[model samples]
Target: MPHSQDTTPIVLTIAGSDSGGGAGIQADIKAISATGSYACSVITAITSQNTHGVSAIHPVPLEHIESQLDAVFSDLNIVAVKIGMLADADIIQLVARKLRQYTPKFLVIDPVMVATSGDLLLQQSAISTLKQELIPMADLLTPNLPEGAALVGKPVPQSEEEMGALIADLRALGAHSVLLKGGHLEQDANSNDLLIQPHSSELLRAKRHPTVNTHGTGCTLSSAIASYLAQGNRLHKAVYLGKQYISQAIAHADELSVGGGHGPVHHFFNGHVNVR
Candidate 1:
């Protein structure tokens, strides 16, 4: 048997499975492929969810989760990793341990705490473990307003200055870079994301689109960032490009009528899938 020489960079997503195909591993694959990267996934949980809300969640067993990680790392050379929706402390510990074992070139962690429909995703106790273990290992941490508030032990920032301060506090927790997403802020014409590095901070802005099809914005954005990173883009450049992609996706989200509630962004807004 011979393996095909697929030289395209591979980005692995360790996340949950959304039945609606709007977020989680589904969105990750679409976003990664849209950015011209091969996407591999290890599902940590399965959720009965749609654009509206999550009705139930089933966390994948530790043994199976570990087996999936082993299978991916053993066969593929992953360039970057995007993490999302580890439901509990045990899963978080397992993921953190595996990351230490198989260190990818770029690791983007999306601290998914709650769903757009206000359903709690991550367990309350898992928050501490995620901060103490996973945050330190991540190359970049992407948190929306509510998740940021949960992580930093305070309310989400209300202004640009407050966002900067929140970034500083988040950096103190351990991630090399922190990107505080502004989607959860008050409705505005412009969506601004604050990216904070060790020495500097940058605000990546995009035109806000008025649409309810925002089911998986966080998952899509973080996966896009990981995809660009795998393609050798700099951290800031990756974030900027990811922001652009999501903005376009959001802008054209209405093109698809997937669900009655918050629909997903159009991941393949360009009308062509990039995977080989």
Candidate 2:
């Protein structure tokens, strides 16, 4: 159905499932909904994970993933789509094909490669698929230090300037805009996140919150960006709003602690304040 009154934006998250509810599809749904957008989802994989780390990952079959996509796209308005972990090349190709067929307005991709514990998540075969199919389709791409390095085949960025430079190179690789996350290495407890647009070398800096509970920050940020885009915000404005939302979520993370190790950000920080 079309959006009621065409005011509330509808967003879809195509990603893997997180049993522990800290990251992946779980985080995506939480983030999008928390931002006042209608959230729909198509799960790519079912993962057994917790605060400590990922225990097991079971990728859904290619056909099943496509069916899930069809079910959502055929029924929902789907103003924007936020794509997360697709685990393997076949899954990535499936998602790419569906995107080509449906062609959603705003596509935000979060290139999830490694866990917070420094464990590899995406298979090597999927790298080519992401670069060839997904990145080019993305209106905006969000990648952390490790994911960015994996995409560009370079070393971890040493400085904010270097990261911005690397982000520009990455945008040239495929994405129209890039948000290279600096959550991996913050200077003086102040994290730096940069958003670079096409035809412009200037990097837009966003204030980062210093918090250890960042298990699903990348997924949450990308989803929030998609939600904002669905609501008709400009590219830079969407990124800025997403930055603020994630920062507050991170700052309030301690109160929403669910895991013993790396925990989730408070996606509903505004909702909590409204209740008070």
Task: Please give the TM-score that candidate 1 achieves against the real structure.
Answer: 0.96
Off by over 4 Å in 2: 1-5, 202-208, 272-276
Local error of candidate 1 at residue 264 (angstroms):
0.7
In model 1, pairs of residues that clash are none
Kindly state the number of residue pairs that clash in model 1.
Answer: 0
lDDT of 2 by residue, 1-276 (tens): 554736769899999898888899999998998887989999998989988899899999888888988998888888999999999999998899999999999999999889886767899988988999889989998999888988999888878767866855687768888888888776735677777788764454555666678889899999999999999999988998998888888988877747789888888887644423
lDDT (CA) per prediction: 0.91, 0.86
Alpha carbon deviation, residue 23, candidate 1 (Å): 0.6
- What tens digits encode model 1's per-residue C-alpha lDDT throughout 1-276? 543446578999999999999999999999999988999999999999998999999999999999999999999989899999999999999999998999889999999999999999999999999999899988999999889989989877787677877866888979999999988766666889988899888888887898889999999999999999988999988998999999999998888888899899999889884422
* Global Cα lDDT for candidate 1: 0.91
- TM-score against native, each model: 0.96, 0.94
